[model samples]
Target: MFTREWLRAVVVVMFTLAPMSVGAEVPWQFADNTRYMAMGDSLVAGYGAIPATQGYAYLLYKEGVFDKIPNTLLSNVGLIGATSQDVLDKQVPLAIDPFVPTVITLTVGGNDLASILTGADPATVLGNFQANLTNIFFQLRTALPEAKIYVSNLYDIPEIPMATEIVLLFNGIVEGVASGFQVPVADVFSAFEGRKGLRLIQRNGADQYEVHPSNAGHRAIAKAFKAVIENN
Candidate 1:
């Protein structure tokens, strides 16, 4: 069994391990035309990946999994340790809206519960995260009226059972919110389930369930978003 504060400890470890320069460089393709804006936490930032650019946003842009509409620009402003509130209060207006992004992808709420999923009143944290998330969606719709908004539901962290439970609840909220706004959800949860080391995590062989992604995992995320984009 992991530590009592296992999930929180893992997240902090990941954040600490992430270098300042990890995600700073953008592929030439992204810099030239950033029609897509990725906003969220470490997952979106690709913290645990060997090269931060191996994260999902870059994969969606670079992975030739499915063809994108020509000239689609993708940019990721996802920050390590960012919570849903951070996205609402800080990252959104400053980074997202001004870009006039044609497509916006969000993956948030997990960090809001960090150590608190085991707390006495976890519902309170979930509620607050939901409110902040709803506001983010509403604001985005208002600011980028014509933009397509896609939300990535929480995916399970295999070593932590409580985290999976949290993923269920958090993803439910994501589904409900997306439904209300008539937005599409990229079910990154299902995509990551059952194949942690192989499909999702960075490690191969016996141990892949820890956290973060391998290059192939990032490509999977890219495909999930691509599916949403194509269907919607």
Candidate 2:
């Protein structure tokens, strides 16, 4: 027969080796009535994805980044060609009023930089972008003090001249503004850096190129958002 002390020691070891509960490991819970709003440009609208449903915003909703599908209601107000000013003027109002989002993801400023391609002064474009982005964040934070907001930085396209440099500047602005409002930034720039087959425009053989993420790229962007949300 085993000694009482030996049996007690065995039980202690078994208890010590037991696995932790799944709930304890997870950082977030599936809270009820989570309203998620996505605001930005073409990427938010899923332009590059064939059906658009494959866009990062949709994927985040479908995959339950913020909460479970049953508990999460997603409203994507990301216009196809929306600039920072457009988002401030159009999307923010909707987010504040009827939607009253508990969670928001914004992706703007790319269209603001497009003005540079048309001979608009880079300094002027960047200044407007910075001001508009600052206002966008300020309004959202002020209006929805309890909501969690995440923003994405721009990715680099190697094909265009000085694209990398310009994108870096834009990402800097994104980071600076986001930091001011205590908003987390999804580092899409790093996700696409030196990566092949992320841009839909690159896959097409035509001389003209459009600056949008492919399906795989959307997935990458979703992953970036998910990472920040989970950590935050």
Q: Judging by TM-score against the true structure, name the best candidate.
A: 2
Per-residue lDDT of candidate 1, residues 2-46 (tens digit):
222442343334334334543553333233444666789887988
The lDDT leader among the candidates is 2
- Using Cα atoms with residue i matched to residue i, what is each candidate's TM-score against the true structure? 0.75, 0.85
Looking at model 1, report the run of 10 residues with the lowest lDDT sum. Answer: 1-10
Q: List the residue pairs that clash in candidate 2.
A: none
The true-versus-predicted C-alpha distance at residue 159 of model 1, in Å, is: 2.1
Superposed Cα deviation of residue 63, candidate 2 (Å): 0.5
Q: What are the lDDT figures for the candidates, one per model?
A: 0.69, 0.82
Q: What is the alpha-carbon lDDT of model 2 when measured against the actual structure?
A: 0.82
Per residue, candidate 2 scores C-alpha lDDT tens digits across 1-232 of 2233443353343233223432232212323468788899999989888788899998998887888665665667788889998888877888777567899999898888888888999989998999999998888888999999999998998898888899998899889989999999999988988898899768758344588888999999999999999999
lDDT of 2 at 34: 82
RMSD of each: 9.3, 15.4
Q: What number of backbone clashes does candidate 1 have, counting pairs of residues 3 or more apart or in separate chains?
A: 2
